[model samples]
Target: MELVFATHNRNKFKEIEAMLPDHISLLSLDDIGCTEDIAETADTIDGNAILKAEYVRHRYGYNCFADDTGLEVDALAGAPGVYSARYAGDQKDDKANVAKLLEQLKDKESRKAHFKTVIALNLKNNENLFTGICEGKIIEERRGEKGFGYDPVFVPNGYDRTFAEMEMKEKAEISHRGKAFKALIDYLSK
Candidate 1:
């Protein structure tokens, strides 16, 4: 079966693609000629994922899935939750977002945070939602060269290093997106 993963990020596509079975073929937004940026105007992660998945299903007539992830900090009152991507600005600069988050938590004691990923799948005109969360704390500074978004400074619980410090396979085993995709893949296999 062929499915479109509604995203332009090659890193994200590659990550999920590696987890898929040989029977299933994955396609990106580019592969389907979907160059236009899908607007994520929803107030919540679930809503955003649904919006993107539905948009592609209706507009391009493809079986697709889209995911929205957020970094919610306990000290910030769950801030930067739905607005994680553009937290620093509309530019969606990862470095700027991390810097802003670090600055905001500079004086705070509780560094508790979690990464949440919601994946919405539109298949055969039916919709399904899957969610995964990785609980951790934001470190004082960036740590690794791998991974993207807030991975450099955000470390998963029970781990000394951040997501960026871990290899792709290691990070996927414990990442929010990884867990969510696991559910989605299981569903697809059935």
Candidate 2:
């Protein structure tokens, strides 16, 4: 089953492709000659995911899936929820986003946070949504250098190491996006 994953970010494409089974072939925007940047103008993660998926399907007439992830902090009242990608600016600088998040979380004790992912799949005019969450707390400073996008600052629940500190396989086992894609696979298999 070949499905286009509506994203220009190579990192996201790689991560998701690694998660998908061998029978499923994943294609990125680049793979299908879609150099255009799909706008994510929605106010919510779910909406943004849907928008991306719908955009690809409408323009290219392909079965596609798109995902939006957010880092919701209890201390900030879920700030940066829908703007995780552009939290620092529109450039989507991962380092700058992490810096801003750490600055906002400074001097706060509650540090409770969670990473949430919403995936929207457009298959033959039928759209489906799946969600996943990984609960954890924010560290005072960045820890490791493996993963991207606030991975250095987030320590998943029941784990001592941050996402950046974990291996790719380990992170995949517990990441919000991983869980969401797993659900997507289950839905597709059914």
Model 2 residue 1 lDDT? 95
Measured on C-alpha atoms, candidate 1 has an lDDT of 0.97
Per-prediction count of colliding residue pairs? 0, 0
User: Across residues 1-190, which tens digit of lDDT does each residue of candidate 2 receive?
Assistant: 9999998888788888888888899999998999988888999999999999999999999999999999999999998899998999999999999999999988888999999999999998899999999999999999998989989999999999999999888898899999999999999988
TM-score of each: 0.99, 0.98
Relative to the true structure, how large is the alpha-carbon lDDT of every model? Answer: 0.97, 0.94
Best by lDDT: 1
lDDT for each residue of candidate 1 in 1-190, tens digit (9 for 90 to 100) = 9999999999999999988999999999999999999999999999999999999999999999999999999999998999999999999999999999999999999999999999999997799999999999999999999999999999999999999999999999999999999999999999
Residue pairs with clashing backbones, model 2: none
Residue 190 in candidate 1 has what lDDT?
Answer: 93
